[model samples]
Target: MSVLPLVFTSGWASGINAYAVVLLLGVFGATGLTDEVPASLQRTDVLIVAAVLFLCEAVADKIPYVDTVWDTAHTVIRPVAGGVVGALLAGQSGSLSDITAGVVGGSTALASHFVKAGTRMAVNTSPEPFSNIVLSTAEDLGVAGIVTFAVFHPTAAAIIAAVLLATGLAVLVFLWSRIRRFLRRRAQRREEKRLADGGRIPGRAGPPPW
Candidate 1:
């Protein structure tokens, strides 16, 4: 079977939760459920580490600002993970060039990551914490479902992932205004907090230069 579908699916999942993607793929590989997964992903140490990080992300992703912070931190990590996984998958399957797979996976992941980040920013504008938890839970379930399904039905999973990616991007675009407003408000709050903590405005400070 062509591994392109699985690569795309995994990349989409990784944008939301790289650790979960790694853990799921690793488990699937280790349990003899699929041979398309690379052996490197199935190592005991790899699974354990992925499990630990997945738990951390699961917790961090349910909190409001914490989730945004976590997303910011993973901005690079997720895309990199997607590329590496794609390269590995291609290498294992020998159906596609590793570089081509890596680029496709990384680009897909980057686009999805932007959608996730923008949507979260818009969501965080809400005062309630429950939305964050609900959204985070939904994302986790979605990633798990799509990834597991990919192991059995790669082409179908890829199509589903593509639809989801399109939907997410559309939603992000719809919420772009709200996301921008939220960012402005957040920056204002941060600046206010910094000033409150004795941070002075450049060239307009009252404190002595001592």
Candidate 2:
């Protein structure tokens, strides 16, 4: 069987939560639920590390600005992880070259990462933290479900993943202007508050307050 479906599905999931994807795949592989998973990922140490990191991510991802920081840090990590997983899946089949699988995985992960980051940025514009928490939880659940389903039904899962990816990108595109405007307004408000608090406005000659 072609591992392309698994590669794409896992890549999409990794963008949302790389550690969760690793943890789930490692667990599933260790438990003999899937034969296509890489042997290295099935190691106990790998599973433990993935689980620990996933826990930290789950907590950090619920916080607004903190989640942004987490996402920024994982920008490279997620794509690399996806590529490694893709290569491993291809290795199992011996039909596709690891490099080809890596390219597919990395590219997919990168695209999904942008979508995740953009959506999170927009959500962070809201003052309430509830939305962030809800979104984070939903992402975790979605990754888990998609990964598990992909193991058994890769082709169907890939189609579903493609649709989701398209929808997310479309929504992001449609709201890009609104999100930018909101960010600009937010910056203006912050600047105004700073100025009101005795901060000098830029582009004006201001006597230094001794």
Candidate 3:
């Protein structure tokens, strides 16, 4: 069977939580759940690194501003991970060209990453941290569930992932205003901090000269 479905699903999941996807796939491969997983992904060193990163993300993703920072840091990492995984999957299955799989995975991950990042920015506009925690937990579960499901039912998982990606994009579009507000507020905060740290120069308390 072709590995496109799994590649697509993994790409979408990778956008939200690349380490989790890697960790889960590695575990599955090591356990002999499936032979489709690449040997490189199942290495002890790779599993350990992925597990550590997943733990870090699981913690950092539940904090509002921290999640946004984490997302910013992974903007490149996620897409690159997706492409590499896709290429490996293709190489193992011999069902598609590595370049083709890599491009599809990387582009899908990039799109979904935008949706995740934009939604998080909008969510950060909320005053409380509970929402972030809830959303983060949901994303982690979703990534885990979908990737595991893909191991057993690739086509079905891909369809579900497509729906999720579409829904997330729609929600992000609806929340564009909130995302913009968050960006503006964040910029203001940075400017305020900079000014505070730099010590503003004294000035006359009068209107500027016309």
Question: In terms of TM-score, which candidate is stronger, 2 or 3?
Answer: 3
lDDT of 2: 0.88
Residue 103 of model 2, lDDT score: 89
Q: What is the C-alpha RMSD of each candidate to the true structure, in Å?
A: 2.5, 3.8, 4.1
* Tens digits of lDDT, candidate 2, 1-210: 788999999998888888988899888888999888888899999999999999999999999879887988989998998888888889987868999998888888888887888888888878899999999999999999999999999999999989999999997897787669666976898889887757765765674465
Q: What is the full ranking by TM-score, best candidate first?
A: 1, 3, 2
- What is the overall TM-score of model 1 with all chains considered together? 0.95
lDDT by residue (1-210, candidate 1, tens digit) is 689999999999999999999999999999999999899999999999999999999999999989999999999999999999999999999999999999988988988898888899999999999999999999999999999999999999999999999999999989999999999999999989887857665777675455
Ranking of models by lDDT: 3, 1, 2
TM-score per candidate = 0.95, 0.87, 0.94
Candidate 3 backbone collisions, by pair: none
Local error of candidate 2 at 63, Å?
0.6
**Each prediction's Cα lDDT score?**
0.93, 0.88, 0.94
Top TM-score hit? 1
Give stretches of model 2 more than 4 Å off: 182-210
Clashing pairs in 1: none
Please state the error at residue 159 of candidate 2 in Å.
0.4
Where does the lowest 10-residue lDDT sum fall in candidate 1? 201-210
